[model samples]
Target: MSTDPAEAAILSTLAARGPSKSISYAEAAKALAGNPPDDSWHKSMHPIRLAAQRLARAGQIEILRKGKPIDPDNLHGVLRLRLKEQPE
Candidate 1:
């Protein structure tokens, strides 16, 4: 479990969606902010992105742009997150 709420929320949200599905930063932020999420949820976006960068670098998650995985360090524009595929 991550000490960071954003990291935990991101992981849990993606886990709930399963490996084949992905979610946007806003989605993760809303999840972190909780259901019926308020405007304050927007505040979580940067931290969510940061946690996503860390997770992607660690191979715990994959970052996508234009529906394809891209360099985690080059994150920009709209991005999505999904669990990294597991070997069969």
Candidate 2:
């Protein structure tokens, strides 16, 4: 339970997806912004991406791009957030 809408949304949705699945930052962004699953959701990506980096640093999640784990600090293009196998 975090005050950050992006953090909350990312953590909650990955939990909802269960341990084996992953969620895109875009998906978490939409859920956080209360935006419908449409083009408008794209607007939430930047914040959600930032939140993902923080979450990853906290060991709460893993940041990924193109099906591979990525350095949140080096995030460039598209990315995703998934619950870490052993989150802190």
Candidate 3:
């Protein structure tokens, strides 16, 4: 699997944030530091969103919409993500 530095960094930050749930793109960008892939925060945000989507699909994280948990909220809309618990 090809690892994306930006995606990795964002995931790490999410792991660190933990529990409370839901993160905004602006907040994520600031936490990652240095602009994302495309240099423009606007353009760069797409990968971060994609990473979150992928993680959610793999059951590694939960995606939220307006604070309530949901699956695949509209991509063009605002997104919020939280880590998922591993099966015990």
Candidate 4:
């Protein structure tokens, strides 16, 4: 869990969707911006991506491209976020 709103929203949204599902940057931005998100949600894209990077680095989540995990620093194009699968 994170105190930062972006990070927390990312986690909570993903958790709600379950581990096998992934969310687009826009979805996380919407989650942060609130339901029926306003145009201001558009402003949250970069910050949400950055927060995903931080969570990815900490092994709390994964940044995916082409449905495969990619290094957060190298993110590009359309991306999705999902919680890192816990080892059982």
- All models: lDDT? 0.93, 0.84, 0.65, 0.93
How displaced is residue 46 in candidate 4, in Å? 1.1
> Candidate 2 residues 18-70, lDDT tens each?
98688877679889778467677778887887889899999888887887888
- TM-score top scorer: 4
Please provide, for model 3 over 1-88, each residue's C-alpha lDDT reduced to its tens digit, 9 standing for 90 to 100: 2287556756776777876655676556654456343445555466777777777777777777776667754555566777776667
What does the lDDT come to for candidate 2? 0.84
Worst 10 residues of 2 by lDDT: 32-41
In model 1, which residue pairs have backbone atoms overlapping below 3 Å? Answer: none
The best-first sequence of candidates by TM-score reads 4, 1, 2, 3
TM-score per candidate, chains pooled:
0.94, 0.84, 0.69, 0.96
**Backbone clashes, each candidate:** 0, 0, 0, 0
Off by over 4 Å in 3: 31-39
TM-score of 2: 0.84
Report the poorest 10 consecutive residues by lDDT, candidate 3.
35-44
Model 2 alpha-carbon drift over 4 Å, by segment = 35-39
> Of models 2 and 3, which has the larger TM-score?
2
List where candidate 1 sits over 4 angstroms from the true fold: none
Worst 10 residues of 4 by lDDT: 11-20
